[model samples]
Target: MLSRTADHLFWMSRYMERAENLARLMDVTYQMSLVPQSEEKANQSWNAIITLNSLEDAFAAKYPVVNGENVLKFMVCDSDNFSSIYSCLRLARENAHAVRGTLTTEMWETINYTWLEARGRSFDQLMAGGIADYFEWVKTRSHLSRGVTVGTLLQDEAYHFIRLGTLLERADNTARILDVKYHGLDHGGEEGATDFYQWGALLRSVSAFEVYRKAYRDVITPERVAELLILRGDMPRSLLFCMNGVVKNLDLVANSLSGETARLAGLLRAQLRYGRIDDILEHGLHEWLTDFMDRIYLIGDGISRDFLVPMVEAA
Candidate 1:
């Protein structure tokens, strides 16, 4: 495959996954913001929002207050915010446009129509008790596009690259989602009644609330929540599940020159697969999450160096 085509496929899928992740994260943020918070917890929660998106300076410049409404605007509706859902969909559509011939008609239509429909959105309208609905729509649209891609596209290198992007993006997101609460809650103390709600909210943000119940069959606890989100393979949004998919796809896409890509994927998968939640906690959840995200970056870079860059050099 051409380097340009591979790049487009990889990035298009990444953008889609990013958009979905932002929507879901925003949903959780909104829900969490409504609850009573300690001064310390409130500050930590608001800071996590800025840090998670890596937009602290920009957000501070735009809004002096880091309240729920302002954070929602920065995350959802700010066109200048490159990581916003609007920009993600725009970039996804643009990348898809460059490789229109490479995508199945259904795949193209799903994303293209999503981008087009998003054009008519009024941010003000959505803020009036409909933002949650808007976030759900974004998630639904992304799921539709991915389902179409899986069902309609040929299972070739293009599909493999797409899968690589999706899983890597998802792995990064799951890690960040898990870490968002690391500082927001006091983990060393007995589980307070409030801790139960906070922990349950964290699980629900990733759509893991019911799955958490099904897996543990006990009341929610920080340790169990971490274990369920981090190590459980059956949890679709779990870090290990996403990493497992990334490794599988990278293996399928591997070539003689692509050893580094597959190796990194395998290494990370092994680390997560054999990892215990207790180990992660002992190491510090923030540190563990930071390491996971950094490794994901290395794996993505390796893919570009091995497969994507070689084509560029040849051309």
Candidate 2:
């Protein structure tokens, strides 16, 4: 396959995964905002919202008024915002369109239909039936597309690349969400009421509310939620699960390239395998999460260098 084709497939999956994550993150943010904020909670949530997506500068420039509506619109629907949910989905469809023949019929159909649905949504209409409903719709479409891609796509090199991109994106976003929760609760002293509600929102946002409830069968706590999201390998969006999936796909790709991508995969796998939950917690969650995200980006760059970029393209 041409490197260009592989690159497009990789990015196509990354963008879809990113869109789903953004929608879910926003859902959690919206719910958190609904709970009455103490001065600390307000400031923490505001800062968390800005830093979690690295949108501090963008948020300042786009919205002179830093309120919820402005933030939500900018993050979710602003066409000018490159990392917005709408923009990610648009790019996903465009990338998929570029290498149409490489994808399964169902993959193409799913993305094309998603694009068609998004194209019809005007800003006013999207914000019409409450932002919650709109977020839900986007999340549903994203989940459906992933299902279609996995169920119908062939298990070829293209499939592995797609899985690689999706898993990488998932690992990064999962880390980010955990960062938001960790930082917001790190100075935990006074905001007990808001903290509990925020904890519930965090669980629900990842669609792990029911699973977490079934497992714990008690009140939501910061430590328990962190354990569920980070250490639980069975949870689809857990850091362990995403890292494991990436290792599997990268192993296949490394075999294809005769071990070119092996070091990158090996490094990440070792970090997760050897490190314990206490290590992550005791070392300060924010710094640990920041380092994890940096490593994920390095892995992605290595993948691009070894697999996506052709000699001519590099030239």
Of the candidates shown, which would achieve the greatest TM-score relative to the real structure?
1
RMSD of candidate 1 to the truth, in angstroms, is 2.5
Model 2 regions lying over 4 Å from their true place = 38-40, 189-193, 255-261, 310-315
- Model 2 scores worst on lDDT over the 10 consecutive residues at 255-264
Each model's TM-score, in the order given?
A: 0.93, 0.92
Model 1 lDDT per residue over 98-123, tens place:
99999999988899999998867768
- What is the C-alpha RMSD, rounded to one decimal, of candidate 2? 2.4
Indicate which candidate wins on lDDT: 1
Return the clash pairs for model 1, or none.
Answer: none
Reference-based TM-score, model 2: 0.92
